[model samples]
Target: MSIPAIDLMTTLRSGHSTSPRLTWYGPDSERVELSGRVLDNWVAKTSNLLQDELDAEPGMRLGLALPAHWKSVIWALAAWQLGMETVLDGGDADYLVTDRPDSSGRHDAVIAVALPALAMRWPGELPAGSIDYASEVRSHGDVFMAHTDPSASVCAIRAHDGQQHLHEGLLTGFAAPHEDGVRLLVAAADGLEAALSNSLGAWSSGGSVLLAHPDVELTDKLLAAERIHGK
Candidate 1:
């Protein structure tokens, strides 16, 4: 008998508690993956911490200002859980945007990005939402879902790259192609950011952010996000 490959996302959706929750954290010389409810407790404790922290942070946009580590991944996901926008800029602080054209010949979609790599040249010129960070980053997750207009069904999962061999989450905005297969492509930058933001914030355990040299190749992880989305 053989243990077939599993789709973490699909498994998650099937009321199966077996989808593993793993997190990645490290410095230049070392890295580790931590799991179980300690990580869970940490996330719950920190979700409130972020809420309290953002009480003072003006502008709804909050940046995870720390080396890539367990806390970093937790905080990013926790913020999203609270209904905040968590931006993952590959290098600089800017998140990738999907620049696809609309039905018309003209391009119409646009999203705010805060790429630290962009090198803001002005005073307080860093990108921001119309509100303070708490406002922009924190929201009632349930209400957010209730208010959202129904759109295509989306799958969400984690440890996507390992089993799926998905590169960074640059893959398609995944949809179930059957019970066992998934569809994907390089998602538009904004699309990728929004999808990851949703999953990072909403996942049972917040998503992971593997910190590396700003120029490290994350294309695989981006595509991997889609593969994981098969759930």
Candidate 2:
């Protein structure tokens, strides 16, 4: 019962550890690039945070209320790696991760995420029971060790429309298609599901992804500068 997400992350770490796996462009001239190893580190730390601090485990629904951003991507991967289901619609979750902490009172635990790359902590006061992700994630281990492994048949993603995607079918059935070794550009306007699907397609095919913010114009110069091969 091999987990596709875990196997994919392992492949990424072992294959091209130094090359940029995810590049992001946002407003205010924000450009962030993460190599395979760095991306794994972020995912590992996040998984550790969920498992050790929050007691996240298999079959739990982790709601992601955030938009299509790098941090959101990391959170999704972390949830999958920990055998938790990612609820994209952000409803009926055991733990909810959101930027708007005030609206997440129903969940058992809430995590406030700051989207900025340089943010060391949540900019404003969080709700009384919420955790600040930016401040707390750094203290966790860079490597993660799961206490329990999820079967391949375990549900992975709960889509916005309530469709469930299992771990075994995540890459082959759910992900978008991409060329081998392609440098694909994914737009934020395409939504988080598209971004995740495209990224999985790219990474699984030994390619990379460039995720552009909705506000960041996709210009000819930018496309050429990034050496993008496909959308």
Candidate 3:
């Protein structure tokens, strides 16, 4: 019998819920770990907020103007869950999400994000129409129901060094190696492509990812300490 098709959110919510799914290392050796269940909960809340509060639909375009942080990862997964397209360049978006203090964009909706894990708010007044993401997303439920088909386009990224197109189908087909429990170590220098690819691959293969901020140097000793098996 053929298996039913599943989106990224479904994939995340299934399987070992308590297994470690993401490990992030920031400047000053700050480390944060998230289990599969925790990550799924965050994704669900973000998705609910996007679909319910923001009126985001499958074809909507969202601008992601943040660095390779864990929150950014959550936002990407939420966008995929809503079947929305994520534009890394922040071009012509229906909504724009950023951690930058000075919000500058042409998006209809703006969300100012605070990168700190414990930050409960965006701090101070933002642009007139902008809102604090951390504060708003918490009120959302811990589950999501997709409004579009899983086969529909979820995201689009620049391909061939911005010379071609990398559609959702092709991205979905980029499977990871069958090796179980693969823990990938990611660097900010790898850019969005590496971040998304590694994230997707790890989740698809029932593995996890470890991300390091640009300010932190990843050494062999650190890799050994973190038990990072791949990059």
What is each predicted model's overall lDDT from 0 to 1? 0.31, 0.89, 0.73
lDDT of 3 by residue, 91-125 (tens): 67898889874546477678889987878987777
User: In model 3, how large is the Cα lDDT of residue 100?
Assistant: 72
- Best to worst by lDDT, what's the order? 2, 3, 1
Consecutive 10-residue window with the lowest summed lDDT within model 3: 1-10
Per-residue CA lDDT of model 2 for 102-151, tens digit only, reads: 85369889999999889999997877999999999999998888898887
lDDT of 1: 0.31
Candidate 2: C-alpha lDDT = 0.89
Better of 2 and 3 by TM-score: 2
lDDT of 1 by residue, 52-167 (tens): 43331211333433433344445544443343333343222221121111122121111222223222322243233222222232242211111122111211222233222111
> What local lDDT does model 1 show for residue 20?
31
The lDDT of model 3 is 0.73
Question: Which of 1 and 3 is ahead in TM-score?
Answer: 3
Instruction: For model 2, give the 10-residue run with minimal summed lDDT.
Output: 158-167
Tell me the RMSD of model 3 versus the true structure. 3.2
Regions more than 4 Å wrong, model 3: 1-6, 101-105, 147-155, 163-179, 219-221, 229-231
**TM-scores, one per candidate:** 0.32, 0.96, 0.85
